[model samples]
Every structure is written in C-alpha cells, then in structure tokens.
Target: MSSDDNAAHMKETKEGLHSDHHVDILHAEVLASSDLMNDAFDGENHEHSQGLWQSVKSHPWACLWAFIMCFTIVMESFDMFLNGNFVALPAFQRRYGVETADGKWEIETKWQSSLFQAGQCGAFVGVFLAGPVTNRLGYRWTTILALVMMNATIFISFFANSLTLLVIGQAFEGVPWGFFIANAPAYASEIVPLALRGACTATLQMSWSIGSIIVAAATYGYNKRDDEWSWRVPLALQWIFPTPLMILIFIAPESPWWLLRRGKKAQALRSIERLGSNSNAEGTQQTLAMMERTVEIEKKLGGEPSLLDLFKGVDRRRTIITCLMYASQNFAGNLIANQATYFFEQAGMTSEFAFQLNLINSCLQFVANALSWPLTAWFGRRTIYLWGTATNITLLMILGICASIPQTNSTNYAQACLGVIISFVFAGTLGPISYTIIAETSSVRLRALSTGVGRAAYYVAEIPMIYLASWMLNPTGGNIAGKCGYVWGGTAVVCFVSAYFFLPELKHRSYREADILFNRKVPARKFKSTVIDVRENE
Candidate 1:
C-alpha cells in the first residue's frame, strides 16, 4: 500500500474509535503519534522547564498574587481554631453556661457541638453556591464578596449575647469561608506557572496553619479574662485580615483561565500579561494556549459547563478522585488536631497548657507547611498522601492506647504532645497536598465546579466526622477522651487504602495532559510512566 493510503486508513480508523468509550491498542498508537507530531509542529515554543526559583524570578507579581490570594484560607482555619479554643474557655463557658451535677458552670454539649457544626453546614452552603458565583463573578469578585460576607458575619458574632445567635453568626461566617476554600486554590493554580502550582496552592494549607496559630495565641491571651469580652474580643479580631484583604484584592488580577472560559479572549490575554512579569511573556502565552486548548477540547467533549458534567465519563473519575482526596483531609484523623485543646484538657492538662500546646502545634504545622514546598517538589502527591496517612494511623493508635491507660498527669501530657505531632504530620502532608490534587485532577472548564464539589465533599465528610468527634469528646456525650483516637485511627486506615488504589501521581502533569490521561483511561499506577504528547493529546 502507498504511504498516503496507510495514512488515510489510520485516520478513518481513529475516527471510528473516537465514538467508542474504549480505545484499542492501534487507535491509541495513532493518537499518540498524532500528539507527537503536533508537539513537533506547534508554534508554541515556550518550555515548562523552569525550576521553582526560576519561575518565581520570571513572574514575581504573579507569584505574589497567588500567595496573597491563598492567605484567605487562614480565615477559615482561624474560625475553626477559634471555635475549638473558645469551647475550652471558662469565660466562654460561663457566658452560655448550663448548671451541672457539681453545681458548676459548663457549656452544654449540644452548644459546643453545634458551634463548629454550624460553620461546617454554612461551608456546605457556600461550596454549593461557589460554582455559580465564581462562574459569573470571576475569581477576584467572588473572593471580594466572600471577604465582605465574612466581615459582616464576624461583626455579628462579635456582638451576639446568646448561643443561638453566636452559632448563627458562625454559620454565616462559614458561607464565605466555604467560598474562599472552594475558589482560592483554583485561582492560585490558574495564575501561577505550572512548576510553581503545587507550591502556591499548598500555601492555602500554610495560611490555614498561620490562622490557627493566630487564634491559639489570641485565645490563650484572652481566655484568662472573666468577662464576655474575653470571647467577643477574639470574634471581633476576625476583621484584622479580611479588612486589609478586601481593600488589596481590588489590585489583584482576575484569573485568566476564568476569563478565557467566558470567551473574553482579549481580557484573558491582558490578565495573563498583567500577572506575568515582563520576562515571562513567552511562558504566559504558552500557558494561555494550553488553557485555551484544554477548554476547547472539553467543550467539544461535554458542551457547556454544568454541575452534572462532573459526573460524566472521564470527569466522573476526576470528580470522584478529587472528592476522595479532599475527604482524606478530614478522615486522616484531623479531628485529633482540631479538638486538641479540649482533648488535652479532658486528659487532665491545665487549660493554659492545653492552649499553649495548641499554639505549639500550630507553630510546628507552619514550619511543616513551609517545608512541604521542597518536599512536594521532590515527591509526588500520592507518595506524600499515603505516607502521611500511614504515619497518622500509627500515631493515633499509640495515642489511643496511651489514653486507655489509667489517668496520670504524665500520660495526659504525653497524649497532648502526641496530638501536636499528629497536627504537624496532617498539615505537612494531606492538608496541603489534597488542595493541589483537587485542582490538578479536574477538567479546566469544570475546575470551579469540581473544586466546589470536592470542597462540599470535604464539608460533608466533616459533618459526620465533626459530630462524631464532638460526641466522643464532649463531657455530656461519649467523653471518650484519648480513646477517640481509635475511631480516627480506623478511619485513617481506610483513607490510606483508598489513596493507594485511586490517587494518581500528578507530579508535573499539565492541565491538558491530565485530561488526556483520564480520557485514555490510564491506570493510576501507570500515570508516572505513561508519557503522552500533551501538545495535541487533548
């Protein structure tokens, strides 16, 4: 046969295979060759070969914008820590105290549990709404609106005199907290260079630790007070970060990816130009082209963006993996870290020491998150996630055994210390890594929707987990104290198993490359070795 005839035959065969859900070996080889040819011929010449430092030097403004936007995650973390800390406060307890058998003041278990649960519920609402809001308003405005809502809710909580009002205020706060959580990582991923995307998105986890540190310090300082002002002061302090952010956010650029998805090509170009430093122009253009091509391919495959699209065909896997990844954050025994102060106190540590331990844990988490930049650069996301989950399971099991022992100040202290170590591991690994995975795994057109759904899964996981943690620890409920670790230890085992089987290594896969891999139905184990010509793979 002539070469031209062979080419025509292959082309005809490829078209037939495209309509099928499965790809045969011959079809796969042809598609792979086509992609290779495209890469060889495509005019886009910029390389993603730059290291993190080189990328930062090339796009300083863009990196800074990503860092600043990621800082919003701190507020969400701060709210969670603030509620955790306050529940242990004598002053806070007295303000909403109910009589106990000993005739002493104590916050009811229901109120204690509902405070954080309310926030999670609100977060669920925000995650549900984030897709529409971000799609319509773009990243910058969605963030600004979240800040505005957060500030309003904080002020409401600052003035509330009753538990119901306070819980309501916290729920309101969760709305924007959810919005920021859903959108900020997506925004950072879109604006930064591919080499720095993991590091930048990981900043959300770092900011979360920073916020926890701040709340711990603030709560530690004020928990000693005897007035309503003790709790109210911390509630009011929520204004500190967002007030500055709201004003400064106007100066930041909208996500170029979002703009392009909306068909605003000129504005998307301007956004990319503004975000990238002058030296990064070529890379910016390459990135823009990559994004454009990914969107075009997705549109051809799935038509317009819809929430339902997340569950269809290849995206179904994306959505499930992303959701499971986010769920790993909660299921990896974070409950131990989240309620550390309470657990420490229950185990017989003084309130002061418990708060101090919480503060110390936050500091360690901050350091761990900082260290994760290099670690993430060095290792794949799946490796870190599995390792972290395994470590957490071991630590939680040991802590549970220690708690099951007879109560001694020394044993309690040891439990508190162990909790600190768990915090460090969780923050360093699953917390930061999951955000990057969720962002990387989703289709470009459904990035916002996928992230929102993933975050909703996170909150959904939290709903049952939070209630269980509360029931186990609350004096009026299960009051399991150190033994609570057993429950989470079991959960961590499940998380580890899921990650081993499902989480693919997305180490440096470009957005389009990921889509191609998923479309090809590549096994998770093969992702590291399966090289696709991303140039025309989509």
Candidate 2:
C-alpha cells in the first residue's frame, strides 16, 4: 500500500476498534503488516528484560510526569484526612459542635457522619463524571479541570458558617478527589514501560500517605488555637496542591493510548518521545506498535469497550477482581486506622495525647507506605496483600480483646498503639498494591472506565461503613471505641479468604501476557504457574 493509503487504513482500523470495538483479528492492519506485528512483539520482550532501574533510566520523563500527577493526590488525601480528623479539633468542635449535657462541646453523630462521608459521596459522582469528561477532553485537560474546580470547592469549605455548609463544601471538594483517584493510576499505567508500571502506579498510595502525614502534623499544630483559624487554616491549605499541580498538568503530555484511540498517531508518537527519555526513533516506534498491538487484542476480546463491557467476557472477571481489591481495603480495618485521632480520644485518652498519637500514627503510615514498595518487588502483590490482611486480622482480634479489659490507661494506650500498628500494616500491604492490580487487570481500552468503576465500588462500600463508624465512635451513639476492632476483624477475615481464593499474581507479566492469561481463563491460584506462548508463528 502507498504511505497515504496505509495511513488512511490504519486510521480506519483504530476508529473501528475505538468506536465500535469490532476490529477483526485476521483483517486488522496489525496482522496485515507482519513486520509491524513482529516488531511490536519484539518490543514487548525487550521491555520484559528491562528491570525497574533500567525502565526508570529509559523513561525518566514518564516517571517524572507520573510523580507530578500522583502528587496531585496530596490534595485529596489532605482533605480526606482533614474531614475525618475535624472532630478531633477542640476549636472545630467549638465552631461546629453542639453543647452536650455534660457541658462539653461535641459534633453530632449524624453531623459527623455527614461531614466524614461527604467527600466520598462527591468522589462517587466525580468518578462517573470523569469517564465522559475524559473522553471529550482527554486525561490532561480533565486533570487540569479537576484541579481548578478544587479551588472553587475549597472556597466553600474555608468560609463555611454552619455545619450544613461545611458538609456541602466537603462534598464539592470530593469531586476533584474522585477525579484524581480514578484517573491518576490509569494515567501512570498507560504512560510508563512494563518494568516501571508497578512502582509508578503504586506511587499514588505513597502520595496519599504523604498527604495524610502532612495533614496530621498541621492539624496537631493548629488544634491548640481556640479561634476559627484552627480549622480554617487546614481548609485553606487545600489550595496549595491544585494551583501548582494544575500548571504542571497543563504542560504534561497526554496519555498516548488515548491519543492513539483518537487516531492522532503522529501526536501519539510525539508523546511517546516525550515520555521515552532515552529511546531512539526506532525504540519509540516499537513502543507505539506495542501499544497498538495491545489495543488490537482488546478490540478482538470485546466490542464497544464501554463500562458495560467491564462486566462481560474476560473483563467481567477482571472488573470483579479490581473492585474487590479496592473494596477490601475499606472492609479490612483501615477505617478505624484512618479515624485514629477520634478513636483514641473515644478510647479514654486525653485530647492532647490523642493528637500526639495521631501524628505519630500518620508518620508510621508514611513509613509503611515507603516500605511496601520493596515488599511488592520481593514478595509479589498477592503475597503482600494476603499476608497483610492476615496480619491485620490477627492484630484486630487482639485489639478487640484488649478493648474488653477494664478501661485503663495501659489498655487504652495499648489500643492506641495497636491502631497505629494496624495502620502501618495496611499501608504496607493493600494500600499501594491495589493500584497495581487495577493497572494490570483491566483491558487497556477500558482502563479509565474500569478504574473509575473499581474506585467507585470503594466509595460505595465506604459510605455505609462511614455511618456505621460514626455511630460506633460517637459518645451519644454506640461509643464502642476500640472494640470496633472485633467488627472490622470479621470483615478482614472475609478479605483474607476471598483474596487467597481469587486474587492472581501478575508479578512480572507484561500487559500482553496478562491479557493472554485472563483470556484463556486461567484460575487465580494457577496464575503464577501459567506459561504463555509468545511465538509470532501462530
């Protein structure tokens, strides 16, 4: 075919795959050009030989872009932590809390639930909205838009007069949180080479912990002030992440996969060049062909490549695994760990000491998140996830057992210490690795939609759990305090059991290998032993 004819034909194939999801394996241009197909397969093998260090060296710009995008997660985490910790601030209580029969000011169980879950509710909306918006504007503009929207939403939060206003502000703030949560890891997964994929995507969780740590320290520092500034300062700080991040995202390269789908192959090649810091012209074309090949495989697997496709064919299993990976995090006791400051005070510690312990707890969480990277590398995703959940279950049962003893400072301290430890354990395991699973499992065409759906499941499960948590922790409510560990422990048992039986190990597999395994319907337990046939002769 002439060059012009070939360009037109390639565009037609991409449009078929993207618009209709009906590209035929035999007729598609991927097979039409045997040399292109062979080069694409060769690129996949070269990518496999490259380790994490080499991948980083090969794609430094990709790593940097992923870092900046993940850094935007700091905004979400800071706001999320601030929402859960609000009641821990005496000044915040004075501003929003009601006077109690015992002469202490406290936020209501109902109001507390509303405040704490408000961001999540908005996040749920944001996750769904991102799909259509990203389809229209692509990932880069969607991120920039979300960051700008955050400034408008946080304004409502910083100047709120009533508890009702505060809830509304937080809900609005959550829309951007949802945007980042659903899209950042998806972006990271698409832009990086296979060797850098896990680390790049898992960086989302590390950024989350960094945000939590900063908020914890800030809330602790500002808690002593009796003025409204105590709460206002934290709310105001939300602006810092978006403005700089918005500017950075404005200049970042768009996801080449999205670019390719839109049939902007030239732009896609340029993007790969921008992302591939060390690749020569030939290397960049190989990467592009490799991406094109993966998209073609997905095209053959499912037509339409929409959210509904997430529940059909091989994708159904993938969607289930992705959703469970995320939902398990909530059910497996991090809820209590997240609300450590409130849980500590409810367990009978003084407010000042609770704040101190909360700071320390968040710091430990940051350290744990960092430690999980090496663990993910050595033990694989499934091992760390199952073992972490197992360890959390054991610790939670012991914590519940401790909560049962007559309420003493030693017992309360023990409970506080255990909450800290549980947070550390969870941060090290499920927290970061969940992103890796989401990145690896979903079909390439449906990655953003799948990520949004999976994370939406998290918000869905968490909404009811938040109400339950507020009821359990509120003095006017159940006031079960640390004993909630028993409740979460039961849920952790469910996570551990389900994970052992269902979650697959995708440790060193390239995206194509993952697709082949999932398409062949390999059992989760046998994933590690399944050998893929990579020969192009077929």
Query: What's model 2's overall lDDT?
Result: 0.83
Alpha-carbon shift of residue 184 in model 2 (angstroms): 0.6
lDDT of 2 by residue, 1-538 (tens): 7888877876564444334243343325555676667768778888888888888888899999998888888987888788778888998898888888889888899998898899999999999888768866889999999988998898898989888999999999999888898889889988988877778888888887888888888889998999988888888878778888888999999998888766666677778889987667667767777877777766666665577888877888999999998898887778887788898898888889888888888888888877876776677888888888899999999999998989887998899888888998888888888888888888777888888899899998998998998899888888888889999999999998999999999988877788888888989999999887665321
The lowest-lDDT stretch of 10 consecutive residues in candidate 2 is 18-27
TM-score of 1: 0.90
* Model 1 CA lDDT for position 10: 55
TM-score of every candidate relative to the true structure = 0.90, 0.93
Show where candidate 1 strays beyond 4 Å: 1-47, 99-104, 280-283
Root-mean-square deviation (CA) per prediction:
7.3, 4.2
Query: What's model 2's lDDT at 422?
Result: 90
Candidate number achieving the greatest TM-score relative to the actual structure: 2
